[model samples]
Target: EEDKIIEAEAQKLKEKFKEKSLTDKMKDLLIRSIYVEMLGHDGGFAHIHAINMTQKKNILSKRIGYLASTLFLDKDNELLILLVATLQRDLESESYLEVLSSLQAISRLANSQIMTATYDQVHKLLSHSSDFVRKKAVTVIHRFWQINPNGVVDIDRIMKTALCDKVPSVMAASLNYFIEVCRQKPETYKDLTSSFVVILKQIIEHKLPREYDYHRMPAPWIQMKLMEILALLGEEDEETSNQIYEVIQMTLKRAEDLAINIGHALVYQCIKTILAIYPNEALLENISKSIKAFFSSESNNLKYIGVTALNAMLKIDLKYAEDHQENVVECLECSDDTLKLKTLDLLY
Candidate 1:
């Protein structure tokens, strides 16, 4: 009877240990593993996972999940590598879904620590039968661009392969990454970006566009950058890019009413670059006339920009606006646009 009681007590203790929640397990793991490897105190998260498994519970489903969950979230670099290892080798789709609460935990982690292993894992995720994994993998890869400095990233290769991904999300993300890089300062990655755009223009075989692609493929970055790059280039380069940019801008500008929810700043950048490049006489003969018409019909923000660009032009070559003052006055009188326009009129 004494032996029987002792065995029962041991069994009860085992069960109790198994039932401890994920947080308690994290305390054990961090204290043991991560602390030693990273923090120098201890070094083994196996126990945390051990406890978590014994409990048959989802770490993400519990409150302390945030602590464990963020290990794979955006900022935690080391944890991201660990999570991608699991994503590729440890967890299956159905099990991962039940075990993890937020998708961001896995996706953002991958976005933060992309490497050969992570890249392969992302390809696997894209190839997964699950649409969710494929979609998330695509978005995660695109988000990867935001964290990568140019020296570290193989952007050309990524842009190359991503343009042809079987999945829409992957393709879109890759294109967007390229586009975002276009907005960056030239001194940082000018040659690479310019070559990429120029290559895109010549190889009509892999043709991209200036206008927006509402379909699964949107290449606004490539589209605008291609035009802007060409505009900044010498005569031959400008000829190709300028033709595309001018037409696209004209169409897009017409479509965007004054009350848009976004995109004013990006378009403004395009306009600024063009005004800065055009010669005073050429600007007067070419841009000034249409610019006046555009401002006359535009909303407040457009008017403000028009005035600013005009002033800058006048500053650079007094003859630009001075030569076209009659057209400017006509647009000003008919401006009937906004208070900003009226203010611009008085100021000018």
Candidate 2:
């Protein structure tokens, strides 16, 4: 009886939700009940709520639209059909916020038909001259590719354009997608290695938003991702390989005498890159020494990175790597399960 009463009240609120006369606060209440409060939701009422609120002209309405689209939008094509029209309108609207919400909805929903239909709109926004929109578009494209790689045409061109985009964030997103593409279709992207190396080098040497420091290093995320990409590029090309080694050496030199997780991570990435691109006794010695320094780090994250780096060297130069046996055994006493696993890997 109580459940029936609650259901009846929820239905009444859903009816009130459809009224244009309903205030934002009232609609927000309805949305919170279904999306936040976890009220028993009728699919029909939820669809009505989504459509009615999404068509309204306010941020609250759009917020509700996003919430409905993500939480309660039905799997059937019927509700999505209504949403696709609204999303298209939002995409074409002059308001970037509307476009942003639409993209967010599309990304979360992962409906292949919606992505295919909105491809042109997303492609246009990729060059929309707004860094915010472009970055979102880059992410949406990546999501699209993840959902249905075949649906995205001219993907290489899209990635190349994003990589060269003037905005650093755009380039970062582009590199993320591009790296995946390289992993999937290595042969197709080999020709672009040299160009990507140059881009990665530029980003490493002097990328902006330089104030966003991680472990006292500016933008370590970008630096690490760039280093990973460089390793991939250097796998075949001698020129690229030599350039990668030089960058790794330079990064290692800079990271020397540093004491931060990000700096250790940078060194970690550098050592990993060197192993991938140009593994040699001399380089392994440097990496082994660096990993030794990292083992002494108080931070578990740095210590784990140290263990991982040492393990990579163990596969190549077991003679030199054997020197770290005591340190690796000591890591077995660490609390972190991941570090323990890495230590076991090193030992076995």
Candidate 3:
């Protein structure tokens, strides 16, 4: 039944393309609808139409074309090679939106072939005038790194520059990239620890632009990513651990004061970081208080996070779990079975 519907839709799309009178707006609409229908199935018939759309001067048509191509073609698809020139042209286009759309398409459809063909063009966009372009470029580089690690030369140089990018969105994207890289080789990125610490300090002080604020929290996503990266780098390294201790303490204190859900999330990330670094007794007690507070929350999500954090803390020092026994027991009565199961794991 589904395949028959897709065939009908494909045939209608083909007929629409045959009509030279069809407006770009109408073409875009038809392409979008057919794209949705073609999502999971083999959409070989619409491939040529999608390719034709990429050749159109209309920006909307180009976007739909790139999107459709992403859906129809995988990394290994032979047709992907044909997109290399078009993608490269858009990557070098004077328009930032065009460059952004091309980067996005490459990021999603990236394979060894695409990465090999567009490596330099994508790399050059890292310094594009638009922060939006720069941000997307960073993610494309990250994808390229994943596709072919050896292809991305001078990674340390690339990351150092990206981490210091003035824009919050770019910085956040770079941090995500760094998190992936550092997870595999923490020692290589330990030198960049001070840089991350400085960025976190700036964020904590509300130095980022007002636009980046989420519910009055200054770039909460960036803060969370920083904490995660710090955890990875600080693990079993005393000097790296000591350098971030003060900032981590400040983060915990700040996170504790906010009443919003983002605040709770920051607090949870701080707890995980505290565990990774050998935190002092005072910090441990403070985190314990935060975990206990979660148990009192009406939100099951908060309760679940609290239970999970407590379980992790116990592994470091079973004594911490002793204080949460009552809270853990209270969780057993919650209606969420997943939360109850986590509580059971803590009990065991």
Output the number of the lDDT-best candidate: 3
- Every candidate's lDDT: 0.45, 0.74, 0.84
Q: How well does each candidate superpose onto the true structure, as a TM-score?
A: 0.47, 0.81, 0.92
Residue pair clashes in candidate 2? none
Ranking by TM-score: 3, 2, 1
- Per-residue lDDT of candidate 3, residues 211-289 (tens digit): 9888988899899999999999999888899889989999988888898999999999999999998556877888999
Provide the global lDDT of candidate 3 against the true structure: 0.84
Q: Which regions of candidate 2 deviate over 4 angstroms?
A: 1-21, 34-48, 73-78, 211-216, 236-239, 255-258, 333-341
| Model 1, span 1-348: residue lDDT tens | 654554454444345445656454554443333223333222222334432332334444332333343441345444444444344443343554532322344444545344444555544454556545555655555655455544335555656565565544445455555556545543343444445444434332224342334332234344445445434442224433434444434423432332232344434444554554433244334446544644664465556566666775565566665554654565466545664465465455
User: What's model 1's lDDT at 270?
Assistant: 44
Clashing pairs in 3: none
- Tell me the tens digit of each residue's lDDT in model 2 across 1-348: 867776777767666656675564655655655643355545456555666577778976786767776777644546677777788888898988888888888877756788877988988899886788898898888888887878887777888888778777888788788678666665676677667666655655656666545555656787788778777766656665765666677677766746665666678788888888755466667888888888887777777878878877767777866677777777899888998987887778
Worst 10-residue lDDT window for candidate 3 reads 34-43
